[model samples]
Target: MQKESVIKVEHITKTFGLTKALTDVSLEIGYGEIRGLIGENGSGKSTLASMIVGTGHPDSGEMWYRGEKHNPKNMLESKEKKINILIQENGTINGLTVAENMFLGKESTFSKSGNVNKRRLIEEGSKALARIGAGHINAADRIEKLSFEDRKLVEVAVAMYNEPEVLFVDETTTALSQKGRELIYKLMDEMREAGKTIVFISHDMAELERMCDSISVLRDGHFVGTLQKEEITQDTLKRMMIGRELTGDYYRGDYEMSYQEEVVLEVDNVTWGETVQDISFQLHKGEILGLGGLTECGMHELCKIIFGAIKPDSGSVHLTDGTKITSPSSAIKSKIAYMPKDRDLESLFLATSIKDNIVMASMDKIKKGFFIPPRAEKELADEHAGKLEVKMQNTSQYVRELSGGNKQKVVVAKWMANGSEILLMDCPTRGIDIGVKAAIYRLMEQLKKEGKSIIMVSEEMPELLGMSDRIIVMKDGKQTGEFERSEVLSEHDLIHAML
Candidate 1:
């Protein structure tokens, strides 16, 4: 059977100054199909989507929507033709209510003689939310009142309300819970039934296999190939996406390094509002502990608690070396480092130079008394950047120009340069490529060898299993189970414990 093409790209090439974001990439998505776009960060997946939505323009070639040639000058023009994009970044206004955000520009429709009709606006927004199976959200509630997952749902609601012919979801599921993910999946099915085409981008390969009718691989601004469902496997997809066969374990390799058996850090019956309840854990010197759980299972809150990002209402954390710390400032003073899950928002200074970002964590190292030595700072930055294998033209280049993987490496380099002993990493490998993931794992091993204790929080089951000497599973703010690396636990067991 011949498939109906909804959108077609022919020899599309987009260049940003000297960098080739896309190189003569050609692809097609059929009507009602969910197409997966897989690639490493900076591989041009986002660039292609931006070009398709008219936020970006190709240097050469053309794109077609339905049967008509499309050369959308801007996002408004593309929206006029029923093409919408939901970017990875949140685009909603924080001050607005959920209803107002959902309707946004369309709120003018509720105006009666130029006065805003609040009642009608809320009513319409409520109905729109119901249509997308998100009726639980209060239309009048402020956007800031909702959690990150709920905010993401509102963004999806806005896109669905627009009723576009083609929708692009770029790495949105990582923020969502399993239930929320299911809700989005159901909406995708409903949209497909209504003849909408979807371009889905995610780091989770299992999800892509389940949702996508076909998958396209991109690497270094070039289109590698597209594969049908039957023609693709996760390993095959990884190989195609990165242009190499991934070897070794995805996590920590076998090592004989042993900790002092003395607990270096301990959390005693910690409570963080309702999210984390009576949680207790211990970290020994030179030990890597893995935290695994479902989205709402308190693992994230636990990490934040340990990192001093959030203060626990009850209980106390103490360093075994006889130092007491109460805040993130104290934690940093104690040589503890936290690599946040949301790297863009929490860890990185995006507009700053890579050199500046690398040195941001440890300014005292390059300081002589109260004065900062610029020469020493530059030398230290260069050394760490080279050690991390950060692929940048120059250390002075803005961090925003680096790929997601390289940006993450800079985060690691920052803490490593500071000589941090206890590292708190929450989803460190999220959205990074296999090559970079391998590099990070190798770094973890090296850190262990240097007597740095790591507390890794990851959603990927394999990562938790492969990297940690011991794994702890949490559910509903409580520790449900624990496994030693020698125990050989399965993903099912971990998922069960998490759920």
Candidate 2:
């Protein structure tokens, strides 16, 4: 028997200038149920969610909340209706305290006599953090001081603090670690038990299969279908999402540790503060060295150290030719590229055009004397962006308008345009759909075949196992285990080292 619908949309149509975002879409989400939203990048999943949360509006549609006509002008109105959302990108304001971000636009609650009670605000923020199993975070600290993972948790606390009747999680787990993901899972389970609703959006098919009561798919602004929990599988979900049969292994096929013996780059006893301690590693020609660990295990800091974004206090990073890498400019000059874990903040200039961002790192190659010829820059950007299959209306489109997966593609395209011989990819496929993930993996394999070295740092165990020629596991700022590619290697082996 079908449960009563808590939320419903009919004949929803939305457009952004010349692009049609959604068309004639309709769906129903039941109370006390987890509904999964799956689609390729630009398939209108986020668009639909944005409309429901009042961050956007439909060109023509009717929405009902518990059988009432629901048309909210803004998120504040939706909040009054007890509906909330955890957005995909970073939502917290910089230069603001955790408590301030948690209670943004609602500070009047803590005000008396035209003055705010800062102490009360922090105390309430602490309670909110504790409710989501994240009491370790200091509510008084600045939001910028927290790591990307912790900041994401703060967004979760913000979304849940009001105890909404409906919660929308859009591509949130991609930024989280195992512990953080477990916390979200526990929270969703608790909400369901309490008769609340969850609308989960993720590109990870396995995650949806495990967490969702039913799965819905969208393709090119149209609703494809929905599958009950019993009918959900990785293959079926992929088919519905991409509108085709996806064959063969999504990752590399062989277990062979293939690479050359020539050392391309070396990290010699690198130590950085309390997070990274006496870590050393070598990148060989045509190698994928995987770095894995828990959220606080310092793997991310190590990537920055190797890329010269953060200088090591007691050690050095050098190329095979004895060139010291001590800054980003030097690293880029040395033919080294870094795709940071935080793509929007570290790796991309979101406010710029796609063509400009793609050609930013290759200025030398695209310039003519003292001027950058527009034709040369456009050609360079167009070639690489096309190679990556980045879905954009044109190279002139602003990168900030593109979807998350497509934004990641722009980041990769920039490095490829630079002809960088050694790549430092930290969570290269983070927040990307299956189709884009496959493209990236294929690109990595091709780079390897061309003798370009890569160091892949990821929190996803399956990615490390599937893509790395050698895996290095870290715990508490130290290397705990190392494994070579083999068919017998399992996630358990990696988890044991991480724990």
Candidate 3:
């Protein structure tokens, strides 16, 4: 039997100002196949996908759809042909109702003689929601009332409502719960059965292996290779993505450092609504305590409470010497630093220079008398930037220009430079590449050696198992299980505890 190509991208090259984003990239996605696009940050994976959707233009190359050359001038043109892209970030309007956002452009279709048919619009939106297994969401409810995971579901519903023949989902699963992810996977299966093609990008290797029919890898703006299902393994994929033989587990480390007997931080009888109840945990000096659970398990909210971003309904945080830190400002004053899950939202000043962003955390260190010293600031920024191996032409460059992985490194550099004793990290390696992740693990170890304590919240099981001195699994808003480093916890064990 002859296979039909749904998307054929040939000799694509894209340049942005002075940077070559993609070079001579060629790929063929067959009809009904879910193609996994795997690559490190800045490796041209997103660039190629953008070119396909017409969000970007290839400097030189052609894309063919159904035996005809297709050059879509914009996303609207691509959408007209039933090609849709779900970006990594949420694109919903928080102030609008779910139904209004879903049928945004085609609202005129729901009008009869210039009168809007509200009932019909809600009915159609409800049907779309049911198809995506998100029927629980009210069509008329404002998007701001929804959780992050539910908002992600709404975005998926919007894409599915268009009935796209070719779908591009880029890092959309990171925000979803296990059930939500299952719904997405089921929808992908149905779409494939209906002869649709999908280009799926994810940082989770397990999901990619389970869902993708074939996988193509890119490295440093060039296509490395493509492999079929049988040829794809975690190690093989890592090697291809990094262009080297990767040794040891990405999370491999022996955290032999012991913490001080004195407690560095303690949460006692914490209660935050019904989601979190009577939660208590203690972190020691120089120790890494990991929190793991499903998206709605309250781990994220708990971190926010401790960091003073959210005021706890009850409970108190006491420091090592029995001193209390009440708010985020006090936490900062007391030498505690927090890195939130969404780097784009909570960390990094996109419009600011890399040097300024890094120095923002250590303004006290750079200030001499009543004025800030430029030389001292540059020296501090350059020192940490070199240590973190942030790739940039100059520290004066804005953080927005750096790749995702490098930008994350800058976040770490900022906190480390500030001499923070206790660090609270939430999904520190969310969207970065394997190489950068390994570097982060190494940095964590270095912090431990420097007698710094860390409380980390992460969704990646392997990372939790690899780097923690102890693991705490939360369910709803309470602690369900605790594991010592020697417990050798399996993925299944953690998943069971989480659910």
Candidate 4:
């Protein structure tokens, strides 16, 4: 028996300025189904999800939910209809208490005489957290106090708090660790059992295969095809995503990478409050040094120390020529680049144009008497954006409008424009699809060939083994094991070190 269609989108079209994000896309999501949506960056998966979740509206066409017109006026209206979204980024505001963050926009029940009952809000928030298997988080604690991974859990809790009939999970697992991801998967399964619909968007193909019943492919905002569980395969999906045969080399070619004798950057006895304890590492010229660790193992903190984004308590980071990196400005001036994990919040100015973002690091170089030449800035930005193959209508498009993968390309473009000698990349491929991931891997290899040093901090072990000249494994904020890349190095060995 065919399951009933719970939500239906008919010939929906959406445009961002001149960029056609979606065109004549049509689909129907069945009740109790986990529908997987896959595409490269800028492929319209998130755009479609956002439209359905009432974050935005399509420029043309109509959608229906439960056989009724479903043009939601606002997020609150969508939730009232039992439709909810878990957005890709951390949506909660900082400085607010966890309870306040969770119950934002819906305080009517907790309100009395124009006053919010703070205790009742906290109690309900605590229950929600516990229900989502995130009881570790304190409802009364400030949202900013939670770690990035924990905050993601809170986002999930908020989305599920209303017991939504149709849930949209948008590239969320990429931000979570194994346990957190497992908890979400468990919830999805339970929701399916309860006859709820899930519109799942993910770059993790493996997870999608395991969790989704029907898989849909979108390429450049057009609905290509939808495959059932038995019909879905990685190669088939990849082909649909790029509209071509994908070359096998997603990482650097299998070769023995030789490191230069010269150390480009040195983190000598760097120490930070509990996060990093007496960490020391050398980023050699032309070497791709990999930092592998579990979530919150302090690799992120160490990257910030190297970039001079955070001050180390007792040690110094320096170029081999003896220039100190005591601040981000000094590091950038010294031809050092840092790509943060949080691309949207940390790496990008969302409201600004792509050209502006690309030219940000090269402001001094493009300046004409303390002012930048508009033409030169645009030309330089265009060159880098083209090199990265960022899919957009124009360089003037706001970065906030681009997809997850394209935004990452912009981040890389910024550093490339600066022509940095040493690059600090943390989770460079996080929340991105295979095509963009391949491009970044190729770029990293090319940079190494150009004699530039790269310090790659990642939780993805395959990427570490695939691209690194030497891998440093961390556990509990300390280096556990170091391995020079070799075919004989087992993943089990790396996992042991991370644990």
Candidate 5:
């Protein structure tokens, strides 16, 4: 039986400059339910969510909430009207404590005689954190001092604490560990039981199938259709989103692969503060090594250390020829490429043009006596953009305006154009759709064929199982088990090792 409708969006048409994000899109979300929103990058999932959450208003559309006109000017107003959203990005202020951030824009209850009561604030934040299974984190600690995953937990706790009528979750689980994810899953179930509405946005199809009561698909800024819980399946959802049947194995199909015996890079006795402890690993030529563990297992930080972005306190990373990498510049100069987790800040200059971004890493190769000809740069950028099949208006378009998948493509194409042989990637397919994930896997296969090695750190178990030749599990700064990827290997095994 269908639940009562809580939100009715009618013929929404939204445009950003020349980009039509949504065209005549319409859907209904009901009370006491979880609805999944999915599509390829640039398919207008985030835009629609933003409209519903008051981040942005649709250029043309009318919405009704509980049979009343729903028009909100800002997020604060939306929150006042019993609506909340857990945005994809870290929405907390770096300088503020968790307690302060949790109560931001609504500190009146804690204000006593025009002065905020810090003690009561911390007490409330602690309860919130504990409710979300994050009791280890202190609410009084500054946001900047927390780990990225922990900060994400704080965001989830704050967003769920309000008991809003409607909640929006956007690409939040990609960075989270399994434990963190379980907490969210629990809250989602609790919210549904309490008759609250949730609009979930994610690129993970399996997660969507498991969590969503109904799934809505969009393609090219147009509404395709919605699927009931019983109708949601892998191929069916893919067909709906892509407008056709998708062919080819999602990951590399080859199991009996050959790798070079020569080790291309080595990490010896690596120790960094309390995060990494006596860690060591070796990467061979043409090998795809997978790292699997909880978000706090130190693999993410280890990637930075391997790439020389962060130096270990007492150890070394050495290349095949015994070249020590102490910094990112040295690693880059030595033909090593690192794709960081935070793509917007660490990987690309968002304000720069696509042409400039593509050629930025390969500037040393394109310079003509201290000057790179614009024509030459454009040709190079266009060649790689074509090679990666990056969707764009032109090479001169700003990269920030592109969707998440395209931005990732730009990052990869830029590094590939640098002619690097070693790739260090952290959550390379974190929030991108399946099509883009397949493309990245294909690219990795091509790179492996060309004798390049990759050390991939990711949280998605299916991806690691599908793509890696070998998987290493870490737990609390220690290696617990290592296994060769085979038909018998299962997520249960990985989870057992990880926990």
Candidate 6:
């Protein structure tokens, strides 16, 4: 006999302006199961999850939870009914303390008359963090002071604190390192053991195959199919997602360490407030130099220093021509571009149009006598958007409407439009689908062929091994090892250095 579903939806359809996000999509999530939701970007995976968690609603559909008609008016209502979600982006508000963010909506739980007991709030928040194996985070600290990984853990603590019957983890793992990923995976396993349901949305195929009981595929706002546990494979899921076979390897095929020896950019003795320590490296003219480390390690900070987003306390970043990059403007003037790990917060102007963002970086280049022509801006945006294969109505569309993968494309598009010679990409492919990953990899190869240097900072070991001509590893704000690309190199070697 088939198992009873904990939640069910029927004939769900949602539309956002001219974009049809979902159409006649229906699925049942079973109790005590981890259901992997896989799809390419803009494939309605997040849309469906949002609807279920009450962050969004369908124009036409019916949903039932525990055999009752269920339609939550907002996220708070869903949380009241033991349903919660950890979103793809950082969910914690900036300017709030860790305890304040943890108990944001449920202030009455610690309210006395009209005043909130801050002490009790911190006490409970610390316990919540401990429950998720994150006791190292201080509840009294400001949320903004924490690292991106720690803020993610705070979100996880909030989501799991209520002991929800249903939890939607929307690409949350993409922001995490191996330790954080394991914490979440262990929590999911415990939830399964307790007969709860977890709707996991992710672009990582290997993670889905390992953690899910069954996998569901969505394609262009439609439910393609679901694979039973025995039927799930990377190849099968990829075919279902893009509706075609992935013809070549997902990463770069060459193993030979090939790049021009001309030193284009150099970082020497860079240190930043204990997060980065005495890191030095030379980026070559046609090289893909990989920086691998744990999320808390200094590689991400090093990328920022290289791009002049963060000034090192005791070191310098300069070019072959002796141009010292002191700030972002100087970096841009030196033909350097940076793609930060936190795309929505750090990299993009979310409230603006795609054309504006693409042309923003190239304003000096596209300007005509102190005034950029509208036609010139449109032409430049359209050219790079087309080159990047950005799926959109037009360049005039707001960037907030684009999917995660496409938003990343816009970040790349802006730099490409700027004619940057040096690229600093920190976690470039985080939370992106395989199709888009392949596209970005191809772009990297093309850039390398054209003698544009790249510094790739990533938490994924496989990506570092696959793309780097030279790999540098870091642990606890210090460089531990470096390796040249060879056919014999493996993830094991990188992991050794990272630890």
Clashing pairs in 4: none
Candidate 1 residue-wise lDDT, 239-325, digit = tens: 988888876466655633356686889988999888888988889877889999987889998898887888899987889766766
Give candidate 6's whole-model lDDT. Answer: 0.92
Cα displacement (Å) at residue 130, model 3: 1.6
Off by over 4 Å in 6: 1-3
Listed in order, each prediction's TM-score against the native is 0.93, 0.96, 0.92, 0.97, 0.92, 0.96
Clashes of 1: 1
Q: Worst lDDT window (10 residues) for model 6?
A: 1-10
| Order of quality (TM-score) | 4, 2, 6, 1, 3, 5
- Write the residue-wise lDDT of candidate 5 on 1-499 in tens digits: 1237899899999987777899999889999999999999989999888887888899898988888888889888888878988866667887899999888977889998999999999999999999888999999999889977788889888887887899888888877767777788888999999999899989877789999999999999999999999999989999998988996477888765457898999999999988888888889999999998988898999999998989899989999789999999999998999999978768889899999999998989999999989999999999999999998888888997788899999999998889999999899997899889889999999999999999999887888888887888888887888888688889999999998
**Between the candidate structures 2 and 5, which one is better when assessed by lDDT?**
2
Q: For model 2, what is the error of residue 161's alpha carbon versus the real structure, in angstroms, after optimal superposition?
A: 1.8
Local accuracy of candidate 6 as per-residue lDDT tens digits, 257-365: 8898799998989999889999888999999999998888888888888888888899999998899999999999999999999999898999999999999999889
Candidate 6 matches the true fold with a TM-score of 0.96
Candidate with better lDDT, 2 vs 4: 2
- Cα lDDT for residue 324, model 4? 95
Question: Which segments of model 5 are wrong by more than 4 Å?
Answer: 1-3, 107-109, 112-114, 368-378, 485-496
Q: Candidate 4 on 1-499: residue-level lDDT in tens?
A: 1239898998999988777899999988899999999899888999898888888899999999998888987778899999998877878899799999999878888999989999999999999999989999999999999977788888889889889999999998888888889999999999999999888999998899999999999998899999999998888888999999896568776657677898888888888988888888888889999999998899998999898999988889998889999989999999999999988879999999999999999998889898789999999999999999999888998888888989999999999999999999999999998988998999998999899999999988888998999999988889899999887887898999988
